[model samples]
Structures are given as structure tokens and as C-alpha cells.
Target: MAGQAGRSAGFNKEDLSSYEYKKILCKKDEIKTLEDKTSHVSDYELCEETVNDFYTKFRTNHDTLKLKCDNENGSKCCRDVNYYLDHATGIFKSSILNDSDKNKLIKIVEEIWEPNLRAKDIYICERQTDLDSTRKRSILQHLHDLKEDEDYILSYTKDYNNHLKEKWEKIISYTDSKPSSLFVKIENNSMGIVENYKNFLDSSDYICGNNLNDLSAHDIKISTDMDDFLTTISLDKISLNVEKNLCFNKRYVDMLKYKASNLQRINNALSIGVAVLGVLLIFIFLYEFSPLGRFLRRRTKKQIEVDENANDEIPDSYENSENGIPYISYHSTSH
Candidate 1:
């Protein structure tokens, strides 16, 4: 029973209430200091009476203040306070006010809040009430600054347009001094070249089997129109010259072919003659070295010697008949 009594004595409700009272007093002193820093109109003692008075005024003018402060800046300020109060409570909720004095203000306001009214609603109402008088003045200042910016932009645009117009006039004047015929001819040639190039690119299948990368400069055939324009002013003259040159080239090639054929025939005849001469020489060599050839030479030599001897013998016989003429005459007389 003594231990129970001692335990009961140790737990004192009055001690807890005294500590809370001291804390509230310290916060009230801080609130008073914060109030001294704020505007005179917003200054108020941090007490239950002051909080109640402010709440009463806010509730009475809530609709009118909300309507007056219905712009983005005012709404954003109100929403910031509302959002802060919604997620926070107790002493920590005071930290949501970034300003040193604002923390004290919020702390005091939160302390005296009624159970029926939410902290978020009360904070939003307070911000709206404060914004009522300054909303119109701020909007007017924004309009004045916007008008100045617009005027400067208009002046800059006008100057830029004038500069562009002057440049365009100079360009036109310079172009007017140049000869139109030269430009016209150049433009026509350029257009023809572009058209020919386009056609050449489009005809990929015929160019080189649709593989453009493999195509060489020699593989590309220039369009006749483009060729004529680049090579000469008169297409007919170019065509006539080309035709004449082609005819001359064809005649020259035919002459070359005829000369080649004649040369080939002459070579063949010379080769055949050489072959016949070589065969004849071979036969003569064989005949001269053979036994039959030697035998024929000896027989011809013997026949020549026999003929000479017969001639000599006939001469001797005639001489002898002359010498013995007397005896011969007597014999012929008797006959």
C-alpha cells in the first residue's frame, strides 16, 4: 500500500500542466517580438483574445476577400499556407512559414483554432483577407510595365522591317544593272543541266544495273539536249560536224582494214614461196651428193672425149688420101 501511494505521488497532473503553461508563456513572448516587426495594421498581441478577434473578422469578410484576391499570385499565396497547415501540426507546423516573423504568426493562429474549423481553411482565409486591398494595386502595376515592353517591341519591329526593305531595294537595283540576256541563258542552261542530271539519276536501271556506287564517269551518258547546250550554241551545227567526223572516221577504218588484208595476203604468199624454195634447195643438194649424180657426170665426160678422137682420126684419113693420089687415079682409070 505504501509503494502504491509513492507511485501515485510520483505521477502529478498539475506538474504536467505547469510545464505546458511555461511553454505557452515562452511562445507568447516570441509572438510579441514577431508582432513588433510586422506592419502596424497586422500587429496584434499573441493571445487567445487576439486570435479569436482575427478569426471573427476573417469569417465575416471571407467571401468578399476571396473574390478580391482571385488572381494567380494571391491564390498561390493562399494555397501555400493551406498546403502547409494541411500536412503539419503543433510546434513543427510553425516552421512552414519561411519568414521568421511569419512562424510566430502561424504558431499563434494555430494555437487558438476552434475544433470545428480546420487549420488549412483558417490559414487560407487569413492570406485571402490580407490580399484584398493590395490585389488591385499590384494588377495595375503589372499592366503599366506590360505597356512599356509592348511599345519597345513595336519600335524594334518597325526598325527591323525598314532595314530589310532597304536591303531588298539595293539588291533589286544591283540586279537591274546587269544584262538580262546573259542571266536568261545561264538560267536556261542550268535548268537543262539539272533536268538531265535528274533524268540520269532516275534511269539507274539502264545506267549500271541499279548500283550507283559501281557506276564510273564513263558509264554516265549525257542527255543530247544538255550536250548540245554545253558544246555549241547551234544544235544543228554540232550534229552536222559530228556526222562529218563520223563519216571520215568510218572511211579511215575501212582503209585500214583493206591495208591489213593486203598485208596478210602478201605475208602468206612470201611464206609459200620461201617453203617452195627451201624444198628445191633440199632436192638439189640430195641430187649432187648421190651416186647416180656422180655416174651421170662421168658418162658425159667420156662421151665428150670419144667425139674429139673421132674428129682427129677423120682429119688424118683425109691427109693420107691426098698423099696417095697417083695410085688411086690409076685404079679409077682402069675401072
Candidate 2:
């Protein structure tokens, strides 16, 4: 018995070892899956961080460029221009500028660089070696070219400034003229006789047809006088009080038109409803008197009679008959 028990104990030890080995293998697979998931998450986070950094740099550079360009008297603009020119080949490779912004930047760079290039050429010519006669001649030629380029730059700058000034003046004039334009619109809208009548109806305390007709004659006279005034008056002649009155008149006129339109729609809806109701009554009357309707009614009555007869013939009970056998009554026809 002792030897047999020893053999069983050895078998139990082998089984437990195999089970632990399988459990360890499962745990290793789980750890590997977790590591893969963590690696993917890290990669995504790194990509997002890179995108944010790119946008931040792009915005910073864009703002810096704007500030540098806006400061005409500062050396920073020159430095920025030089930097961008040096990097011009790789500038559009980034997402820093879209098509329109890139075009504007190119134009600005051209304006800055062309004048600067003239000055640079002049400086280079002045610093050239005087030992070589050929170099001296080349320097003289560069100086002449520099003088011509400077003259061209000056003329172009003047034309650009004048163009900007004209644009600014036009913008200022347009800004100043907006109120007058609005006033003109209001005046034209309010000075109409039909609009005046509508406005009077909308503004009146009572909104009935009688009140509408009663106010018409006075409004017509006022509208005619207002129209004459508007035709004779210039936009500049309109005072604050006149503008306010015109605006009020326009507001009231719009409200009146809205209300009148709504009323017209309501009237149309009511007329349609009445017509529909009349047609429905006519249909009901025709249905009651029509031969087809009478035939349907007769059919329905016959169906009800058949149902009643069927119900009457159904046996109320299956009681025993006189011979003591259960009797079921099924109505039958005899020929």
C-alpha cells in the first residue's frame, strides 16, 4: 500500500507542474498584448504632440512676420526679409501658408527685397578691390545699375503709397456714406402711398376694416407730401430727427405689410376651409341619395340579417333529448 501511494503522489506532482506551465504561458501572452496596446497609444500621443508643436510654430512665425512687416522704421523687418529670402525654397514646403497668404507674402517679399538688393549692390561695389582695373570697371557698372534700380524703387514706392492712400480714402468715404444710404432706403420705402396706408392700419388701435378705410384718406395726403419732400431733398440734408422719423416709418410699414400678408393668408385659408366643408356636405348628401350608396347599404343590411339568422340557428345547449341521448341541433334543408 505504501508503494502504491508513493506512485500516485508522483503522478499528482507531474500534473500540477504541467498546469502551472500552461498558466505561465497564458500570462506571458496577456503581457505581450498589453505592451502592444501601450506602444500604439504612445505612438498616437507622440503624433498628436508633433502636430500641436507644428501649429504652434507656424502661428508664432506668422505673427512674427506680420509684426515685422508692419514696423517700417525697424531693422527687424530687414532681418526678417533676409531670413525669409534665404529660406524661400523651403518656405512653401510647410503648411504655414495657404495659396492666398503665400501670394501676399511673395508680393511683400518682392517689394522689400528689390529695394534692399539695390542698396546691397551699391555697398558691394563700394567695397570692391581697387587694385584690379577690371574689378574697378565692374564696380563702376554696378554703381550705375544701382543708381537706376534706386530710381525705379523710388518711383514704384511712390505709386504704391498713392494707391494705398486712394484706397484708404475710398474706404473712409464708404464708411461715412453708409448711414445716408440706409436713410435713402428708408425714405423710399416709407414715402409710398400703399406702404403709408399699410403702416396706418398696423399702427392704429383698432385693426378692423372700418378703421382701415377711415385712416386711408389722411394717410394718402401725407404719403404724397412725403414723396415730394424725398424727391426734392438730398441725402446730406436729412437731419437726425428726419432720419429717426423715416426709420420709424419704415419699421411700421414693414410690420403693417407683415400683418396684412398674414391676414390675407388667414382669409384665404378660411375661404378654402369653407369651400372644403361645402364640398364635404355635398358629398355626404350625394352619398345618401346615390344608387351605389343605397346598394352598399342594402348589402350591409343583408350581411347583418345573415349573421342574425346564423346566431339564431346556433343551439343554446346540448341537453339530452327525449330518448336520453345528447342532441345537437344543426339546421338542414330537405328536398
Best by TM-score: 2
Instruction: Report the number of the highest-lDDT candidate.
Output: 2
* Residue pairs in candidate 2 whose N, alpha carbon or C atoms collide under 3 angstroms: none
Query: Per-residue lDDT for 236-302 in model 2, tens only?
Result: 3233333321223444355445656766899999999999999999888777999877888899999
Clash totals in order: 0, 0
In model 1, what are the clashing residue pairs, if there are any?
none
Q: lDDT tens digits, residues 161-251, model 1?
A: 3322321222122222331211111111101111222211112111111222222222222222432333322222223332211111222
Give the number of colliding residue pairs in candidate 1: 0
lDDT of 2: 0.34
Poorest stretch of ten by lDDT in candidate 1: 182-191
Model 2: ten consecutive residues of lowest lDDT: 204-213
